[model samples]
Target: MRYLKYFILVLPIVIALEAQAQEEDCAFKLREAQQLYDAGRIETIPEMLQACLERGFTQEDRLAAFKLIILCQIYADDLEKAHAGMLSFLKRYPEYELTTTDPVEFRFIFEKYRTRPILDIGAFAGVSLTHGLISQPFTPFNLNNAKPKYTSDGFGFQAGALFNFYASSNIQISLEPMYAQSNFQLVYEQEPIEGIATLDHHEKQSYLYIPLSGTYEFIIGKFRPYARLGFQLGLLFANNTSSSGIFEGPDEDNLENRNQLNYWVFGGGGFKYKLNKSYIFVDLRYNVGLNQYLVSPDKRFTQPNHNWVYMYQDSDFRLNSFMISVGYARSFFNPKRVN
Candidate 1:
C-alpha cells in the first residue's frame, strides 16, 4: 500500500521529466535542420523533422518546422508539395497575417489563397429604453377637463445570440433572435364627480424578437466601425399591468386584446475591436414601431377591471426604443483560392 502511494506521487514527475527531455531533443533537431538548410543540404531536412513535427514540438517550433519544410520543397522545385504545405499551415493558423520579414516566394503563395471571415457567432446583453407614440388619446373619466400623458418608466433588459454571415470583406448579413422586455407608464389627473384626483398605470411586456440586418463595415487597423439597417418581427408572449395613486388595483395579467405580433424598422452604428480571430464590440440602435395601433379599438372596453377599478382605457400608440449593448464574437474562416 505504501509503495502504491509512492508510485502515484512519482508518476507525474516521471512523465514531466520525459516530456522535458523530448522537447529539448526536438529543439536540437530543429536547429540542426536549420543549419542543414543553410549549408545547402535541403534533401534530408524534411525526413529529419517529420517525427518532431507530428507531436514533439511546441506550437512555435511547429510553425518554424512547417516553414522550413515548405521552403525546402520550394527550393527543390517541388511546387505541388510546397502548395500542400502552405495549405496545412493556413489550416493550423487561420488568423495569420503577412509580415515584411516573410520571403517573397511565401508571400506569392499566400496571396493565392483567400482567408475572409465566413461566419461569426456571438451573444450580447443590454438595456432598452422604450416610449409610446400616441396617435389618439382616450380617457373614460374626464372627457374635457383633464389631460393624460404617457412616458417611459424604467429600463428593460434584453439578451440574444448573433448569427452573422459574411457576404464580402465589408458587408455582413446578420440574424439576431432575442428575448426582450419593455416597460412604460401612463399618468393623468382625473376630474370625477366628487373631486380632482391623480391616476398612474404601468405596463410590463415580454417579447420574442427576430431581427435581420445588413451591415457595412469600415475597417481601420484593429478598429472596425460599422452601420446597419434592418427590420424586426416581434411576438408578445407575456404582460402585466399595475395601477396606483387615486385608484389602485391589484397587479393583473394584461395579455388579452393586445397585438401578439409587431413589426419594427431599426438603424444603428457601432465599432468592434479585434483580438486575433475574436472581437469585442459595442452597438447602439434605435427601433421605431411600424404598427401605429398597439391595442385593438373594438376590444378597448372589454377588460372590466381596467375601466371601473383603474379608471383607465387603452390608447392608440406605437412603441419605440433606443438600445445599447456590449458583446463578444468569435469568427470562423474558410481559406481557399478564388477561381
Candidate 2:
C-alpha cells in the first residue's frame, strides 16, 4: 500500500515533464521554419513544418507560422492560397501592422491583391525628331545623280497615353495612343540640267500614332528604370508641302495622294518615380521605317516638266524619327476595401 501511494504521487510529475519536452520540440520546429524562410529556402519550409503547425505550437507561434505560409504561397505562385491566407490573417488580427523586416515581395503582393489593380494608366508629352532617308533605284547602266536631301533639324511634338498591364514584378506591356505633329524640309541636289539649279521644299504633317510595347523594369526604392521595344502604326491626318514657293495640300486637296499609312519598329528606355499611388515617368525612343514613301510624279524635281502620266511613283525614300516624353500614371482596383 505504501509503494502504491508513492507511484501515484510521481505519475503527475512525470506526465508534466513529457508535455514540456513536446512543447520544446514544437518551438524548435517553428524556429527552423523561420530560419529556412530567411535563407530563401521557401520551397522546403512547407514540407518540414506543415505538420508541426497543426500539432503543438502555441498561439503566438501559430500566428507566425500562418504568416510564413502566406509568404511561401506568394513565392510559389500559389496566389489562390495566398489570398485565402490573407483573409484568414485579416479575420484573426484585423489591426496587424507590418514591420520594416517584412519582405518587399510580400508588400507588393499584399498591396496589389488587397487594394490595387493589375493595370496602370500613364500620360506623357515630349519632343520628336523626324529624319528622311533617300536612296537611288537599282538598275543597270544608270547614273546615281538624283539625290534627295533633308534638313537635319526636323523637330516635332508628341503627346500620348500609355495603358500598362502588369504581367509580373519586373515586366509589363503597354499600349499607347498618341497625336503628333512633325516638320521637315526637303532639298534636291543634282548637277545643272537645262540651266536649272538645286531646289528647296518644305513639308508639315500630323499623324495619329498607336504603339504596343513590352517593358522590363528594375525597381529600387521609389525609383524604377525600364527598357521597352515595340512597333507603331501611324495614320496621316494632314500633310502640307511647298516646292519652289508653290503650295500643295494633302490627299484631300492635292491632285496626287501620299502614303497615309506608316508603320515602324521602335525602342527606348526611361525612368519612373513613385508619387503616392501614382508614378511619374520620362521616356526616349527611336523609330525606323520599313517601307519607302511614294512621291508624286508632277512634283518630281529631277524631271520637273514630267507630265502627270502616273499619280504616284515608288521612290527609295523612308522616314525615321526620335521621340522623348514625360507622363504620370496610377493604379486602380475593383471591390474597394475600406482604408
Best by lDDT: 1
Q: Where does candidate 2 stray beyond 4 Å?
A: 1-100, 103-117, 137-146, 188-198, 245-256, 295-314, 333-339
Clashing pairs in 1: none
Residue 309, candidate 2: C-alpha displacement in angstroms: 16
lDDT of each: 0.86, 0.70
How much does candidate 1 score in TM-score?
0.85
CA lDDT of 332 in candidate 1?
A: 95
- Report the C-alpha lDDT of model 1 over 165-241, residue by residue, as the tens digit: 99988999999899999998886544443354557789998999999999999988799999999999999999888
- TM-score of each prediction: 0.85, 0.58
Candidate 1 segments whose C-alpha is farther than 4 A from its true place: 140-147, 188-195, 218-224, 273-277, 301-304, 307-309
- Lowest summed lDDT over 10 consecutive residues: which window, candidate 2? 304-313
Q: Compared with the true structure, what per-residue lDDT tens digits does model 2 show for residues 236-264?
A: 87876544422232222321345688889
